[model samples]
Target: APAPTPTSTPTSTPTPPSHAGRVLLPHPDFRLFLAIDPRHGEVSRAMRNRGVEIFLLPPSLHDPDLISSSSPSSLSSSASSVGNGTATTATTATTTTTPNTPNTSTPPPPFHEEVRLLASQGLFGSSRRLRAAVVAAHARLAAACVRVHKRPPDLRELAHFAQLASTLACRGWPALAALVVAWRQIYLRSLGLGGADMVVGLRVLAQMVREAGVGSTLGVAG
Candidate 1:
């Protein structure tokens, strides 16, 4: 057999580990936890130019319950009815269609009463941070009310402010009492309300603050 031809087995090449699967890697323009308050639009832009990727921590990440009450159907219904009354009648060539609206046609309850009812129901969620924020905001509102009215805030007023703070916290924003105070001040100023007249303005101010704080947070820019 002529030296039985030397048999050689081919060696298989080892595949290198993929960078795509690696958990950690070095890269420019890394994610930076800059507390950039969205209200400060100018500062935010400046930071973005410095190779810092601003990562906004969404409320849902921390508190899934933030949008738990906001079901698609509920949102759609709320959207369709906002500022247009409960039912909007559409006139067509052949027929008029009036979508079946919820019983919201009834005038909303008085603002203070509504707040009291919400508070009684324990509308606040179960987050320690949220609770603390709400308590601080409530204290601030109470103090402001005392300073303005020369008297302690009524139970309804306190409840209303507490409800506001809790709502803001639940939505994952710092329940800033200063913001609420500013909102009330501005509304009162615009209405030229003084003393007792300011009490009535709370309803409008609450609505304004709630609308403004939607999908908003507080933090230092840059």
Candidate 2:
């Protein structure tokens, strides 16, 4: 008998993400943070040239609740955790992850509860503000990578976010770092809290990037 020929399975081509509707403008302060000119056109090229291999801060390593919220199993887990208050007091940020839905397995880091304790120290108008700021830098990076592209990020975009994050996270951000350091000094003065306070520092990050403005602005709005 003749040897059987090997069969090849057909592979499907992945569809490219559509650049439809409108192109979103990247945030200005964020552009500066990455050293890209705030002006539009050739944005992607600029990012590549910047050689963005950034720092991944341990504090913002992974947001478990935000990551888990996207998981199908999260609802069930949340309900079950009701009996285990040990899980309840762990985190503070309530924002959604953009670009990439992070791996839920990457357990939330310790400061997950840091914001809550810092809240009572009278740093801001509300603790909610602190929470938002904590994740603010991460959120801006997500948008820059692809979330603001007028559609959900594809695998390629998500990968881009991860790269951008790693580079951005490792290197100290001048503006953001300075603010954090200054606030920490003030932290000693007012609250007598340690010089590692993140409340004010995080807020400075949030202020730099415009949240959700990418999709809303119609150049010809009446």
Candidate 3:
């Protein structure tokens, strides 16, 4: 009998052994930030914000202390007030009482609090999507590189392949997908999936550019 006909939805192809490479790479979230184009400045910024959020708040999902700690100056003032329970007034001499001065003593929110707020808002979701996208981009690039017997790809190159291939695959392009998958396979074989996990973020961005097609390229247009 002939092999059974395959019948899975087009959402995702079979993810070949994702564990091929064994080296520990950087946090996948961090790598995603590097893969986006600054030319798509807004998207790139969002991705970075999300990655930072995930790193800062992975386990707790929410930190109430951080929420209340946002206003650094106010919190400090409150603590001081509780400690001293008294106010000491100082005399001020002003040459020009007619002019009004702006208040510069207010402190900005704690930087980490801002980051936490951004993370809670799904800031890092796109970055995660980008990481998954690399699955396709690497495949295509590896095939092309192999045909030419080019140098082995780095994490950045692999990421570019995944970015390009996945974006194209989403748009109903099988040829592009095949190339991406093939290239990624080669990359995986060389380093083992686990090993590839430790690549830097910037390198991942370079890879995305390398594998980007016209649409994906345009997505990052300056």
Candidate 4:
């Protein structure tokens, strides 16, 4: 009798990772996620090589907080989302192949309920107090960055939280968001200052200040 022929095992190709609604990186030791949306695979790879600890995300899924979450999940879970870049971040990064489970944990409740709501309601009796609250909020947020990141929060993250806080207990979200965007533009185009670009930036800054100072409120948009 002829010896039975050996059988060969068939192999399946791996699926490419999807970035949408998934947490690609582990959150070192915090609740909020630092998300990125890398358009190219190389971009994600480069950041990972640098040990940036970022995850790939889709621009459309900008709002991590808005990601429909269920019961509390472990921080160790693969599900992730972004901070501050929720609305209009143009950056990108890598993603994981986790089953599409929504993020389980929500950020802590907004602190100082009075201050967060006072600015938007026109209840602030003095600019001094309003300015003080904003500054204090900024300081309050810096603690997280220093404790975890070992440095003061960068302008981008700082502004992100500032705008985030304004979305609730601080002031007008639009104005704060606009200010964050303006600052971003200024930071990006810092070289353009003392030139025509500076004029444009200044004009925009003035317009933003004027609108914010109007002491009017628009309902918070989702």
Candidate 4 residue lDDT tens string, 1-222? 999999999998987668546558867885544443221123456656756574433343343332222111211133233345563322222234233321112222233332333332232323422333333333333333333333443445434433443344333345445444534443324323344333433443443233223233333222
Q: Rank the candidates by TM-score, best first.
A: 1, 3, 4, 2
Residue 164's lDDT in candidate 1: 50
Deviation from native of the Cα of residue 59 in model 3, angstroms: 14
lDDT of 3 at 179: 42
Ranking the candidates on lDDT from highest down gives 1, 3, 4, 2
Off-target runs (Cα >4 Å) in candidate 1 are 1-45, 59-64, 69-180, 186-200, 205-222
- Candidate 4: residue 106 Cα off by (Å): 18
**Every candidate's lDDT:** 0.39, 0.32, 0.37, 0.36
Kindly list the per-residue Cα lDDT of model 2 for residues 23-108, writing each as its tens digit: 69868766445533222223576667866645433332244543323222222122221223453322323445443543112222
Please provide TM-scores, in order, for all candidate models, with all chains considered together: 0.23, 0.19, 0.20, 0.20
Q: Residue 131 in model 2: shift from native, Å?
A: 18
Show how many residue pairs clash in every candidate, following the order shown: 0, 12, 38, 9
Q: Cα deviation in Å at residue 158, candidate 3?
A: 1.2
Error of 4 at 110 (Å): 20
Q: Per-residue CA lDDT of candidate 1, range 127-175, in tens?
A: 3222222333333344444445544344555455444544444455654
Top candidate, metric TM-score: 1
Instruction: Give the clashing pairs for model 4.
Output: 23-80, 37-92, 37-93, 38-92, 38-93, 56-94, 116-169, 116-170, 117-169
**How many clashes does the backbone of model 4 have?**
9
Off by over 4 Å in 3: 1-42, 46-51, 55-151, 175-222
lDDT comparing candidate 4 with the true structure: 0.36
